[model samples]
Target: MTPSLSRMIAQAAGRLTFPVKWFTYGRRFRYEQPQKGRGREFFQWDIDILGTDSFAADAEIISIAASFYKKLGLTPQEVKIKINDRKFLQEKLSAMGIDPDLTLPLIKVIDKRSKVTPDNFNTMLTDAGLGTEKVSSLLNILDDKDGYKNSEWLTGILNIIKQYGFDDYVEFDPGIVRGLDYYTRTVFEGWDVKGEFRSIWGGGRYDNLTQDVGASQTIPGVGFAMGDMVMEEVLKKCGKFPALTVNKTRVLVTVFSPELFDKSIELSNILRRENTLTELYPDPRTKLERQLKYAARKGIPYVAIIGPEEMEKGLVTLKNMSNGEQKMLQKEQVVKQLI
Candidate 1:
């Protein structure tokens, strides 16, 4: 599941990921509750740039997710991109004397605030050994509905996104952690702003992840993961699905009679030679009305009928379904008629 999702994401972004890291990680597994898009065993998308740390890297990842949603037909209004920096979260946690490691799990818990009651969340904080002061401060930061109270880090990130021309779909959200232990910088999430699902796609910076395993130097990188289920739901709900169709095949050759089957095949070959899509009716037992009706219903624009008379004249009768028009046509003339 993970490899499939990882490959899909790579293709969407016109990139590829090597599988050597999976072997290095020992192919770990963890359980998650099964729901509409969750499962006990599931896909995880990971991406990084081994040497970049510019805010542009962060913005680029966010834009990458946004572009994916755009391709899926989700309107800009229906999608909202949210970002928060792990550095900023660490600083905020540190200011309250809460150990960032201890607080990291709490961040994952707090991420579920929408699913749990306020009383339950508070009890959770108490159980996690958070003092009343730290709890109060954290709750206040989370509940700051108005814009003025937001910290400068958030404002600066937002400003940079605007400079990058990606602010239209971006928002500063304090609650987006991406829940992993390795995120050390900017994190981004895409929300179906008005939908039932909580998040559509999310990713963040993990400068220390590669180094944690073996690499000596730190590698700063950013990327996100998108779930097909949530994205397809959002796209369908918003009517963004493009038409699923195939190349147009306009001409079908009808088998007028068993004796005339060879003539129909010849006419079809001529149409093909002229570069017009042509189908030779497989069975001569069907009625002319049924065969022609099949062509019309299947969106074939032209049907060629070569009976004994037309075969004698070295011509065919081209039936245009659009206006119920029919004309005797030479093999050279059928291509222009269909086109």
Candidate 2:
């Protein structure tokens, strides 16, 4: 299993008050066979808010996750966040006369419903101590899209999520009984609409975890963790990966020769003062052609050459790498062209 930041958060909760919010990003390690989107080590981002049991907290966290996906250029058509409440499911199961002892097992079986065939799922439910009739009733409940109407908690949370303007990206799914047992209410998972990969992210409200971690008092919390690998796969499949430049340096200032290195530095500084990204060649001994090649490979769009001829006239030769056009311009003119 992947390491949890909740335990560490619990340790820190002792000194804090309610409604605490914290986020962490760091490398995570696991010992498991790697696959297309699964790895032994990856970066994960965790965001959690503790000390409130209100449905608003749950809705806020879910909205945060949805907003993150939207910011990454993922649309409701490309991905959706499935949500469910454990307590709501439990109520439905009890109303259906399912044994309290079988609740946990039934939820676990439900979690695997999509992974197994219909026959295998029915068999698994029966093996978990549900009779044929109970299994049939359970399946009907899971398939009911209006089941959330029966739970005031679900209704309130959904309404709050709508207020956050992410209702289109969120939906109720009874089958999303997140695999972790610590989840107490409002469980959620983000999945590609095509169902082409594992969940991009998952979390829910875990009110008792802080107490379990030896806290003197219960600190209700809701959070989610998104791994870099699965997210990358989704972004790739949806053609959402941004076209990022290889480097931030937008201009390369070539040193005409060892004697003109100072001129190159002055030009770089002038461009920088105008908020232009500039890189100066460190080795003046290098040939001008080699410097140009370096800038080309680094994706720098413009290059400034301060050769003896241009220096004599107090001007610069600005070369446009894209069209190979060159212009002789003063320092002020060079800054204007860049900015």
Candidate 3:
């Protein structure tokens, strides 16, 4: 999924209030090769907290994902949220005598460690300018299970997550240096516990993102994006997929005859203006029996029939398709009852 930073840059000019929480879900297109859980075009859900640099912002952004997983019947045993701090890893790299300029490129390499062979991973490090001994040291550091305890910021964020009762779903992973260079701290990914799929979601804090994008003001932000493709796969595998319905038309207005077509259209428009989902029979010449059968097949709950008699009285025959009940009421009264 495309990161939200690109979208937030346009909002920088507005100078929104601090501690802004934004959520959006939409279609995203990518140029990468498609594979399992990966597609060229997909839907993504992005949740972001911006304009605050507090460590609490990091915890809150993470908690949003944890809460969502729990709501979807995904337990801690089925998923884990891996977290790491770039600033913490940067210190380790600097301590190993690596040049400051190479840290970003090195992180890019580390991000791919899971997708490559161990030999290839070492080769990548040396190719990035690390000496043999330095590569050994870096690998040792990455393998350290307790490395996160050394960073106060990392520990603080983890503890905050603990307070939110999601400790089981989160843990520190030293190898999780996200591929993006703009992330200043707190990179995280949601993954299936079985490791059978790509990351379910990923994001981190980008404190300098707005400035990096050429905005006059600096807007600190932390967020994550979840792709629908992988999420749906996970739900089906876990047998938690919910039944969904496609038909949304709540009312169908039938044109009883060619002469009463205008009245049917007018009633349809009126119902729509009242914020109701309405479908008007397109063929004015269609018989009433065919129209009723169409609505029944489409599962429309209600039908409003406008005929010569009903039009003369300024009323509509509202039929409850579910129970085969009909009532004659004024148009206003019908609209109120339908709502």
Candidate 4:
């Protein structure tokens, strides 16, 4: 195997609804050096349901994945992802007289299909203790797994995932060994519809984790992860990443003095009602210009001032930070009038 570590990040969800086995990625390797969206050892957000068995988790995870990609500006049409269960592979292997227990080493070699030669692949399988018959069987299975022309397993898998309501988000593939010994049921990978080399994220069912870790419970779960690195790469390849500016908090509501505190409070309350995020100045003696600069520096959107002229007639002034537009409002109407 290429011996690389991969990470998948998912949102916090309670009680997963899909069966996902543990996926042991290739050798432990991390790039400490920095590059575009990557580091030698960057934190890769991982979301997995180790021990809950259900399809609800799969549905929720896939939906969230779709939502995240959409939020990142990828259309469903541009990205066609695929998912399947490891059980199907095991079943196929069993049919070919390959003991499921031999899955580990064989999987390691299969995962290395990209970086190795065909002759080397054969030698690796022979070293893994597969007889000639077993080798021939494996080769046939691998070759036919990618096509639906004559594989019964492919037919069954396609029908099954469709029933799970993931017909659109998943497909069957024999070549996707996933290289994880514990992946009991489903596995998945996200890819560009055009067959790009990089994928944004992918994962699937694992039902035996809790039991394997010495728990008596057969908690089956399914989930996937998207690393910020690969997702960024995929986005960059697609060429539509929007400029990500640091969104700030804290809107400045000028406090002319304690006299204007009540007015500020009223205006603040009104702003809250309209869902306009803001903050009233805490210091009592800060000057108007100082507060305005503070708001501008902090990137605050709106500022309201209750000066003596407006305060005398029960009025408040609202200022827009970007365009310098000032709006006058009645003191009593200030809170309700400025949205």
| Top TM-score model | 2
> Which is better, 1 or 4, measured by TM-score?
4
Tens digit of lDDT per residue, candidate 4, span 1-339? 101111121221244344333343222237477666565644344455443455556655655565566677787567756655566666767777776678777777876764578999888889888988888888887776455534453455455545655456555556666666667666667777776555556676666654555554555656665566666677787886777767454356688887778877876776676666668888878878898898888788778888888778777787778899888876445455444
lDDT value for model 3:
0.88
What residue pairs clash in candidate 1, if any at all?
A: none
TM-score against truth, every candidate: 0.69, 0.89, 0.81, 0.72
Query: In model 3, where do residues sit more than 4 Å from their true spots?
Result: 1-14, 129-133, 258-278, 301-339
Choose 1 or 3, whichever is better by TM-score: 3
What is the C-alpha lDDT profile of model 3 across 76-185, one tens digit per residue?
A: 99999999999999999999999999999999999999899999999999999999999999999999979988888989999999999988899889999889888999
Encode model 1's per-residue lDDT on 1-339: one tens digit a residue. Answer: 333333333433334343212211122244766677554544444443434666666665666666656666666688898777767777777878887578778877777776678999888888887888878988987665443235564566567667766677887777677777777777777887775777777777766665555545444556665555556666677788677767478788999989999888887787788787778889998989999889978888888998889988988898888898899988888888777
Please write out the lDDT profile of model 2 over residues 143-169, one tens digit for every residue: 987889888899999999999999999
Model 4 TM-score, all chains together: 0.72
Mind sharing the TM-score for model 3?
A: 0.81
- lDDT, model 4, position 206: 64
Superposed by TM-score, candidate 2 places the C-alpha of residue 26 at a distance from the truth, in angstroms, of 3.3
List residue ranges in candidate 1 displaced over 4 A: 1-51, 68-73, 144-160, 163-165, 212-219, 239-293, 304-317, 329-339
